[model samples]
Target: MSAITAAEGNPQIEFWFEFASTYSYLAVMRIEAAAQAAGVDVVWKPFLLGPVFLSLGWNDSPFNIYPPKGRYMWRDLARLAARYGLPFRMPSQFPRNGLLAARVALVGVAEGWVAAFSRAAMLASFAEDRDIADDAVIGELLAALGLPAPEVLARAQAAENKQALRAQTERAAEIGLFGAPSFRVGEELFWGNDRLEDALAWARAGP
Candidate 1:
């Protein structure tokens, strides 16, 4: 099916994603094409889910806490990745520390490198099976995106960027977004990659 098209007037869609989230990778890789066909503009909002979990008293990933879910999630990710023609390999780390990556994303968003940096970081983690928690990997990703590695790294770790990342996370919580890959069209909130199409449709239909 094709993406949604607004009948009269509609608000743009805001896609919130986390680098450490597997399903978000699938959504990020596919959402652009869908948006283009729908004649909709997407606002990419990169945020950290750690704070969201913490607010719910979760110190670890739900998948790790629930073995059955973890197993199913990995398998599901592999299948989806394969279906999308993207590489499929689970990283050694279950939940890589995404703080640095979130900071970098915040910097990128501010500097208009949001999409590029987000794609590179996601590819490194999901496709290449790279340890995204490591600064070196992130630096490599920034370089590959044609960004000044040192400068980006410095900005990512800087107080301002870190605060911005934290603020984004808090804002997500305030907006009732408890998960990754959430799409918001005006006040409407749709969670999960699977709901992307529905979110677009809702966008086309207006608030």
Candidate 2:
């Protein structure tokens, strides 16, 4: 869904993530530092998993539709979060709307602040249990980054930005992405937070 490649000779990996994805929180918080250590570049791809799930004949997160799966997933997520030493709090609302935040992220991508914005947004929803769908919350995120909230928000909400996000999501589906926190090195796709280190290793090794 997104890619961040560095200059020639530097290895890079595409980081595909959705804001509502629980595991993505772990990946998003961890990728930057890990990539830095591996000397690899990361591309932040923010895409909507709703449409992808719909394509698979599912209207909601698999965790929500199946009770047992949902229970196991929450426990697994908590354990993993602790293992990584990242904070995790179950949000009252599962899978909060990320449309607005994703759009704003496209603007941040252009302005070179996507990473900081993404981390803040994730922490807001996953750590603080904030309603990320709220425009005010996103606005606060941008302003906190020293970005001009009104101006940037205006750009993010523009018709063109909306179209861009749509295109990005469509591309995600086209590229065979069925989930978030996926990593791509060339044609290879590695899914899940656990595979993150492997993805970075793949990029670091080069072709």
Which of the numbered candidates is closest to the native, going by highest lDDT?
2
Off by over 4 Å in 2: 1-6
Model 1: residue 72 alpha-carbon error in angstroms: 1.3
> What shift in Å separates residue 72 of candidate 2 from its native position after superposition?
1.0
Task: Rate residue 12 of model 1 by lDDT.
Answer: 84
lDDT of 2 by residue, 1-207 (tens): 133333454688999898999998899899999999998888888889999999999999999999999999899999998998988899999989988888988888888898899999999999899998998999899889999999988998899999999999999999999998899999999999999999999888854
Model 1 stretches with alpha carbons more than 4 Å out: 1-10
Task: Give a tens-digit lDDT track for model 1, residues 139-199.
Answer: 8888887889898899889887778778888899999988899999988999998899899
- Among these predicted structures, which one has the highest TM-score? 2
Report, for every candidate in turn, its global Cα lDDT versus the true structure: 0.84, 0.90
